[model samples]
Structures are given as structure tokens and as C-alpha cells.
Target: MSRHGTAARLSFYYAALFTAVGAHMPFWPLWLKDKGLGATDIGLIMAATYLTKIMVGPAAGHLVDRHGDRRHPMSLLAAGATLVWLLFSLVDGFGPILAVTVLAVGLWSGIFPLGESLAMMETQRHRLDYGRVRLWGSLTFIASAIATGSLLTRQPSAVMVWVVAAALGLTALACWCLPTSVAAGRGKAPATPLWPLLKHPVFLAFLATTSVGTASHTVYYAFATIHWQAAGIDGDTIGLLWAEGVIAEVVLFAFSGWVVGKLGPGRLLIIATCAGMVRWLGLGMFTAIPALAAFQLLHAATFGCAHLGAMHFIARAVPPTLSARAQGMLSAVAMGAAPGLMSPLAGRLYESLGSSAFFVMTGLSLVGAGLALFLARRWDGGTIV
Candidate 1:
């Protein structure tokens, strides 16, 4: 396929996948409430999904690596997720809902790592810019979140499951449309055992750095709005502040290739962690709109740059046969386990220290920076195995 064609195909997949996420995240809790579930029940369900990702996601990755193909497995998982989501309309009460959710999320969550592995391989082969294509997912997520919120003003929240299911069905179709030629491991065993990679000190350091860097967002993700509101910021302005962070992330992604080429993964990760330190410190200390907005722009470096660094690092430093498993483990730790562990801690800190709680996150960023430095010293631009 031409570069444009390849980018378009991958872009469509991301756009479709995030549409389901955008709708489900903001409104699913409301649906659970409507179904007569309490806050505790909802928390249990959400936590179960995270647990599923931590366990099932990596196992699925290992399977993909063994099978040596991404597209077919991705298609099956997406379609299965849609079918499971459809069960929501028929089942009621906490137990049934939680059971279905665990099953569905276990399947749905695998799609991300698999899709990412495929996209990175294709972009490398085609000499295409990954961020340009990935920006579509971010754009669609924003649109979906806004549109779903708007629609909920008139429609019953009961339609939430159907809406997400529709998006999942579109995602399944998009998976079918992905470039077929990019499968890196067809009928081949992974060159490195998963255990050795897991045990490698440098690899563990890579995980710790990326996980801590990403986890530093826990307090902000959980309570930034409440903090701003307590400071007398209105709903509209708070929304704008949140939008600014995502927009900054998108802008960084739009130019990711150039940024990666200039800095390399290790330096880019170090810069991201350093940016996080400054951002969290400012957010903790200031409530003025000017300071908040200024710090918010660092979302590009803290999240966008960190993510770019991780993706490029895996591409360069992991063997091709192990790529799927590597991406899976990264997703499992950075996105799953770290956030899962930090969320409750973040809530407690926010309760005790209020905005000062952000200082703790700053400390986490500082630790991430140190780990990144350690990783840079140990891994010299080559496969760890």
C-alpha cells in the first residue's frame, strides 16, 4: 500500500476504537447508577476491568506473538466485545453487569496493544509518520465525548450501552480494513523468552520509568476538576482547561516523528519526566487560570512525549518476534497496573492535602526521571536480549 493508504487504514482503526472509549468512559457510570448500582459497586466493576487488562492483556499479547498475526485476532476480539456489550441490555443488577463487563473488557482491552504493534511495524516499513495517523484517534475521542454528553441531555442514559456497542461494531469493521501485509511474526517463535525479558534489570527499569511517569497523572485525572471548582472556577472554564491538555497532546503527536528523530527515546523520556516535575509543582501551588493553563500545555511533554518515547523505544530495542508481547507488557504496566495501584492512593492524598496532594505526584515524576536516567545508562540503543 501507498504511505497515504497505510496511514488512512491505521487512522481509521484508531478513530473507530477510541469512539467506543470516548462514549463509555464518561457515561458508563451513569448507566450503572441508573441500573441501581451504588458507588461501591461501580468502583468494583471499574477495578475489575483494570484487573482484566493487567492479566488478560499480556496473555493475549503472548498469544498474538505465538500466532504471529495481529489482524485476525484483533478482529475476533472486537467482534466478541461488541457481542458481549449487547448483553448489557438484557442483563440487570450488579452481579450480572460486573460479570459481563469483566468478560467484555478482557477481550476489548487486547485490541489496543495489538493495534499499536501493527501500526508501529507498518510505519517503520513505509517511512510514514505515526503521530499524524494517531492524531485521528485523539480527535475522534474528543468529538465522541462531546457528542455523547450532548446527546445524553435529551436521550435517556439507558441508551449508553447501545451507543458503545455501535461504536465497537464500527471498530470491528475497521480492524478488518487494516493493512494485511504488516504481520511481523507469521509462523515463527518469539526470539526471546518472555521470562528473560521480564527479569532483565534494564527492561524492568524501562517499565518503572514509564509506569511512574504515566501514573503521576492519577491525582489530576481523579480530582483536578474538583480542585479547580473549589478554587471558584466555573464549569465552562474547567472544561476548557481539560480541553487544553488534550489539544496540547494532539499537537505534540502531530509532530512526533520529528521530535523522536531529534531526541531519541531515552532523552525524550527524560524530558517528559522533567516536564512532569515542573507541571505537577505548578498545578499544586497555583490556582490562577494563567498558571493552570501554562502548566497544562506540558501535557504534550508529560504524556505525548512519554508515549512517543515508549513506542519508539520498543520498536528499536525489542526483537521483531517479541514485539507484540513487549507492547502488551508495556500497556499492562504503564496503563493498567500503575494507574490501578495509584488511584486509591491519589484519592487519599487529595482528601488530606487538597491541591498540595499534587506535590506527591511531583515526587513520583522525580523518581521517574531518575529511572529514565538509569535506563539511558544501561541500554545502549540495542535489543536487551
Candidate 2:
């Protein structure tokens, strides 16, 4: 496939996928609340979903690596996710919702690492700018958040699941639009076990850095919308607040190549940790519009830079044949286990301390900064295995 064609397909997949995410991430807690679940219950449900990613990601990676295909598996997973979300309309209480969400997220989580592996492969082969293509997802995310937030104003929170289900259906279709195949040797056994990568000091540091940095957002992701709403910020404004962070993220992705070149992954991760510390601290102490707006912009550095750093690190440090697996491990640690473990604690903290829960997140950023420093010192800017 032509580079432009491949980029377009990947962009469509991202856009479709994140359209569901943009709605689900900010407002799903609201939906749970509307269904009469408390903050702790919402926290448990969110944590369960996050934890499922740990198992699903690596297992899916192993499957894709063996078959040397991502598109088909991604489509199947998307279809499963859509079906699960549609089933949500039938489930009313916390236990049923939790069970369905865990299943849905397990299937849904696998798609991201596979898609990222494909995107990075294209970046290497075709000189495709990963950031430019990824920006489309961020843009769609902004639009979805704003639109869904507006919808919630007139419609009930029950509308959230259906919108996400529709988006997931589009995502399944988009997966078929991806380039027909990856470069892996189809039907070949993986040459090495994942154990070496698991035990490697540098890889461990890399995980700790990205995982802690990303986990710093657990409290915010679980409670920010609810907190803002409780403070009389209104759903539309809360949507705008979410949009503002991703707008910054989109801008960063648009210029990611330049930034990645200038700073490298290590420095980028460090920057993310620093930005996260400041952002979380500010969020904990203030609820005023100006303070909230200013802190949200730091998301560019916190999430945008951290993600760019991890992707580039994997692209540079890991072999092509192992790309999907590496991406899965990264996702499992950074987005899965760390955040999964943190969510319940974050829920309890948010319930008891309200906005003060952000203070705990700031400490996570500090730990991530220290790990990033270690990674920068140990890594020689070359492939690890």
C-alpha cells in the first residue's frame, strides 16, 4: 500500500476507536452515578476494566505475533467490544454493569497495542509521521467529548453506552480498512521468550517511568468530571475541560516528530513527569475555571509527551518482529497494571479527600521522574535486545 493510503487507514481506525473512548472516559462515571452507583463502586468497576488489559494485551500480542497479522484480530476484538457495550443497555445494577464492562474492556484493550504496532511499522518503512496520523484520533476525541457532553445536558446518562457502542461498530469497520498485513513472518514461532524483556533492567526502568507517569492520571480520569459537576461546573463545561487537555495533546502529536527528535524518549518522559507533578498539584488545590484551564493544558506534556516517549522508545529499542509484543507489554504495565492497582485507592481517596486525591497522584509523578532519570542514564539510545 502507498504511504498515504496506509496513513489514512490508520487514522480512520484511531478516529473511530477514540470517538468511543472520548465519550466513555469522561462521562461513563456519570452514567454509573445516574444508575445509582457510588464513587467506590464506580472506582471498582473502572479498576476491573483496567486490570483486564494486563492479561488481554500480552495474550493478543502473542496471537498477532504468531500469525503476523493485526487487522483481523483487531476487527474481531472491536466487534466483541461493540456487542458487550450494546449488552450494557440490558444490565441495570453495579454487578451486572461491572461484569459486562470488564469483558468489554478486555476485548477492547487489545486493539490499541496492535494498532500502535502497525502504525510504528509504517513509520519505519514509509517515513510516515506517527504524530500527524494520530492527531486525527485526538481531534475526534475532542469532538466526541464536546458532543457527548452536550447530549447529556438534554438526554439521560443512559445515552452514553449506546453512543459508545455505535462508535465501536465504526471502529470494527475501520480495522478492516488498515493495510492488509504486517511484515512479521506469518506462522513462524516467536524466536525469543518475553521473559528476557521482562527482566531487563532498562526495560524495567522504562516501564516504571511510563507506568507511574501515566498512573498519575488515575484519580483525574475516575473523578474529574464528577468533581467538576459537583462544584457546579456543568456537563458542557466539563466536556470543554476534557477537550482542552486533548486539544493540547493533538497539537503535540501534530509536531511530535520534531519534538521527539529534539528531546529523545528519555527527556520526553522526564518532561511528562514534571508536567504531571505541576498539573496534579494545581488540580488538587483549585477548582476555579482559570486554574482548571491552565492545568488541563499541561496534559500535552503529561499524556502527550509520555505516550510519544514510550512509542518512540519501543520503536527504537525493540526489534520489528517483537514490536507488537513490546507494545503490549508497555500497555499492560503503563496503562493496565499500574492504573488498575491505583484506581481503587484513588476512589477511596477521592471519596474521602475530594480534590485532595490529586496530591497522591503528584507523588506518583515524582517517582516516575526518578525512574526516567535512571532510564536516561542507563540507556545508550540503541536497541536493547
Measured against the true structure, the TM-scores of the candidates, in listed sequence, are: 0.87, 0.98
lDDT of 2 at 67: 74
Regions of candidate 1 where Cα sits further than 4 Å from its true position? 26-45, 86-97, 152-159, 181-185, 225-239, 284-291, 351-356
RMSD of each: 3.0, 1.0
Which residue ranges in model 2 land beyond 4 Å of their true spot? 184-186
Residue 370 CA error for candidate 2 (Å)?
0.4
- Deviation in Å, model 2, residue 304 alpha carbon: 0.1
Ten-residue segment with the worst summed lDDT in candidate 2? 180-189
Top-scoring candidate (lDDT): 2
lDDT of 1 by residue, 108-194 (tens): 998989998999989989988888888888777767766776676678878888999999999999999998643544565655578
RMSD of 2: 1.0
What is the model-wide C-alpha lDDT for candidate 1? 0.83
365 Cα displacement, candidate 2 (Å): 0.6
Q: Assess the local accuracy of residue 234 in candidate 2 as a C-alpha lDDT between 0 and 100.
A: 88
Candidate 2 residue lDDT tens string, 175-244: 9888866665546788556777888899999999988987899999999999998899988999999999
